[model samples]
Target: MSVQVKDLKVYYRTLRGDVRALDGASFTIADGEIMGLAGESGCGKSTLGRSLIAIDGRMRYVGGSVSLDGAALPLDDQAAMARHRFTAVSLVPQYAMSAMNPTRKIGKLVTDLLRSRGIAPDTVLGEFRRRLELVGLSTDVLARYPIELSGGMKQRVVMVISTLLDPSLLVADEITSALDVSTQKAVAEAVVEFRDRGFVASTIVITHDLSILVQMADSIMIMYAGKPVERASTDAVVSSSRHPYTRLLLSSLPEVGVRYEEHRLSGIAGRPPSLLNPPPGCRFRDRCPLAFAKCAEEPPFVEVAPGHSAACWKA
Candidate 1:
């Protein structure tokens, strides 16, 4: 496995109390695998992505262990974790377009970032420019400001910068969410290309869009509330969904060749339980269609089929 996360719990420090953003997430990604995390908004998919690389100020690491290539990431210590950021683990965050510094030129910003990581600027710039060209950007992009580039251009630039150090694991949060359909496909393909070319060893793509994951992810993990409810190959999740939540999510997507004039789209009902003082047992009990008395007790994420797992009692 390239990445292993066990019993990971991350909470937000709110004045009301600790918001249980990530109750307990556990999963693995194989070497060179592209794993997609799909869930509704505020379901903690983004929090899981950020927790893997770096947690911001308001986020508090309650407990968990994230290991990349068999070495543990310093989830609680920022200073120690800094040594790993962008080198061993990197994130093309949700807002990659605004990740760059507007005050500094592109090249200057890259140089400053390298210096911060104790890398010699002269040694890396040659490879850096070459990568820029590889991603369809000219070498001169380094001299221009972030505002000068289009949204897609800045996104491409961010992808290059995030992987410049050849990190083993990459967290691409909502990279394609803002782009048009064409640009979305292009960027999604670029991520797979990056994996095939060995720029990053493994990738965790966090998004609510299952369509994007269907295009590139080797496997898909479906999360509900703050934990994973189903995980399997892309084919399994799309065609043979096991968990009720997973089945409900799949039913919500529009199928090709299906006319919507007479057939109305179905939607999952009920609001997601609030993280603050969440109800005990399964967090999804209230909304699951197949929920039972056994669901009142939390179900283990066990394999119901080969290479597949779900946290539902009925699975």
Candidate 2:
């Protein structure tokens, strides 16, 4: 396995109480797999991605184990994780446009980041420029300030910088959310190119957009209320999702050939349950149309078919 997360639990500490962001997530990404994590907003998708790479303040590590390339990650220790941050694990966080330092030139910023990893800037300058070109960015971008670049340019720059050391696992959190439709396709393709080129051994693309996942992801995993509800190949999930939540989510999407004027588009009703002091059973019970008495108890996330898994009693 390229990445393995076993019963990982991460929560956020607030004055109200701990928000059970990641109750107990267990999954594995095979070598070179590009996995897409999709869900409604605040479904702990980003939390799961960030937990594997870094645990920020306000985020408490309740319990869990994250392993990359057979070595265990010190997810609870912030400072100790520095040894793995860029070289072994890296992140392209949400809002890539705003992630750059507005005060410094892009080149200087990259140099500073490389130096932080104990690397001399001159040593990787050649490869750095090449990567920028590979992403359709000009070498002149290195000389400009972040404010001077467009949003897509900034995103590409961040993508290059984040994976400069060729990390073993890449956590891309909503990397394509802020781009325009055209730029979105370009950026999304860039991600696939990154994977195909072996910039990272495997990648986890976290987004709420299922269409994007269908285009690029090898497999898709759906998350709800801080837990993984269903996982299967992209085609399998899109065509025949077994879990009620997954089926409802897929139904809500607008089909390509459908015209809204003639055929109506449906949406999933009801808001997601709050993670703070969430109900004991399935978090999606209240909203799941197929929910029954069996749903009163938590369903184990188990495999129901070859390479397919779901956490609903019906599945």
Candidate 3:
């Protein structure tokens, strides 16, 4: 496994109480696998990604362990995680356009970043230029400031920079959410291309777009209010999901050929439960159409079919 997270719990401290952002999220991403994490807003997908790289001040690592390539990650210790940040694990955050420094030229910024990480600038020069070319950007872009590039260009630049050290795992959090359809496709393809070329071993593509996930991910994991509701291969999750939440989510998606006028799609009826003080048992119980008295108890994420797992009483 390239990445293994077991019962990882990360909470945000507030005057109200501890918001359990990531409560017992456990999964594994095999070598070269692209895992897609899908959920509605505030479902803790971003929290899970951020915890792997850097936990913000308000966030606290409550429990569980994370391992990359069989080595434990010191996620709780911000200073200690510095040793693994770029070299072992990297992130292409939600706003890739704003990730670059406004003042410095792209090339200079890369050099400064490398120096800060104790890596000599000259060491990766050839690889850097090669990566730029692979991403369809000219070497001259090195001289341009962040302001000179378009949103798509900036996103691509961030992708190249994030994978510069060839990390074992890459966390891409809604990296394509802000782009147009064509640009989004291009960027999404570039992510798979990076893995194909061994620039990164495995990747976690976190987004609420199931259609995009269908195009890029090998496996899909559905989360509902700080817990995994279902996990399976992309094909299985889309075509034969067992979990009610997964079924509702998949049904809500409008495919390219499917038109609303002919086949009007219905969205999930109720809003996602608030994570601040979420309900007892399954968090999705209130919204699940198939929820029963058994739902009063949390369902285990068990395999219903080969490579298909769901956490629902109905399943």
Candidate 4:
């Protein structure tokens, strides 16, 4: 496996109390796999992605283990993780447009980042420019400030820089969230192309859009209220989802040629439970139509079929 997470729990330290953002998430991504993580807002998809690369001040690593390429990730210690970031595990964070420093020219920023990592900037300059060209950007981009570039350009630049070291695992959080439909397609394709070309060993793409996953992800995992509800191949999850939450989520998507006036689109009802003091057992039970007495007890994320798993008694 390229990435392994076992019973991972991450909490946010709020004035009210610790927000249980990630509650015992366990999964594995094999070598060369592009796994998509889809969930609604506050479902902990981004928290999971951030945990794999680096944990910030407000986020506390309550428990769990994250392993990349057979080595444990020092997520709780930023200084120790510095040795692994950009080389062993990398992140193309959600806000890539503003990720770069506006004051510094792109080339200088790249050099400083490489230098901070104890890598000689001169050693990788050639490859860097080559990748810029590959992503449809000119070498002159290095001389321009972040303000000089377009949103898509900055996003692609960040992608190149993040994978410059050919990290074994890459966590991409909402890379396409800010782009237009056309730009979104292009950027999404670029991500998969990067994987196909082996710029990274495996990738975990965190986003709420399932349409994007259909194009880029090999497998899809659905999360609800800080827990994984279902996981399966892209085709299986989209076409034959087993979990009630997954079914409701997919049903909410508006199909082409289906006007809401004629065939009304349905949305899942009820709000996601609060993570600060979440209810016992399944967090999604209140919103799940098929929820039964069995749902009062947490369902195990066991495989119901080959390569497919769901945490639902019905499944």
Candidate 2 has which clashing residue pairs, if any?
Answer: none
- Tens-place lDDT per residue, model 2, 1-315, is 989989999999999999998999999998789999999998999999989888889899999798998999999998999899999999998989889999999999999988888999999988999999999988999899999999999999999999998999999999888988899899889889999999888899999999999888999999999999999989989888999999988888898888999987888888999899999888899998888998889999999888999999989
- For candidate 4, lDDT tens digit of each residue in 98-121? 999999999999999999888999
What would the TM-scores of all predictions be?
Answer: 0.98, 0.98, 0.98, 0.98
Leading candidate by lDDT: 4
| Each model's total of backbone clashes | 0, 0, 0, 0
Stretches of candidate 1 exceeding 4 Å from the true structure? none
What is the C-alpha lDDT profile of model 1 across 177-280, one tens digit per residue?
Answer: 99989999989989999999999999999998999999999999999888999999999999998898889998999999999999999999998999988898
Cα distance off (Å), candidate 2, residue 294: 0.7
Sliding window of 10 residues with minimal summed lDDT for model 4? 257-266
lDDT score, residue 313, model 2? 91
Instruction: List, residue by residue over 1-315, the lDDT tens digit for candidate 3.
Output: 779999999999999999988888999999999999999888889899999999989999999999999999998898999999999999999989899999999999999999999999999978999999999999888999999999999999999999999999999999999999999999999999999999999999999898999999999999889998899999999888888888888788777787789887899997877778888888898887877898899888788888888888788
User: Which residue pairs collide in model 3, if any?
Assistant: none
- What candidate 4 gets wrong by more than 4 Å, as runs, is none
Alpha carbon lDDT at 254, candidate 2 = 91
Question: Which residues of candidate 2, in runs, are more than 4 Å off?
Answer: none
| RMSD of candidates 1 onward, in order | 1.0, 1.0, 1.1, 0.8
Which lDDT values do the candidates have, in the order given?
0.92, 0.92, 0.92, 0.93
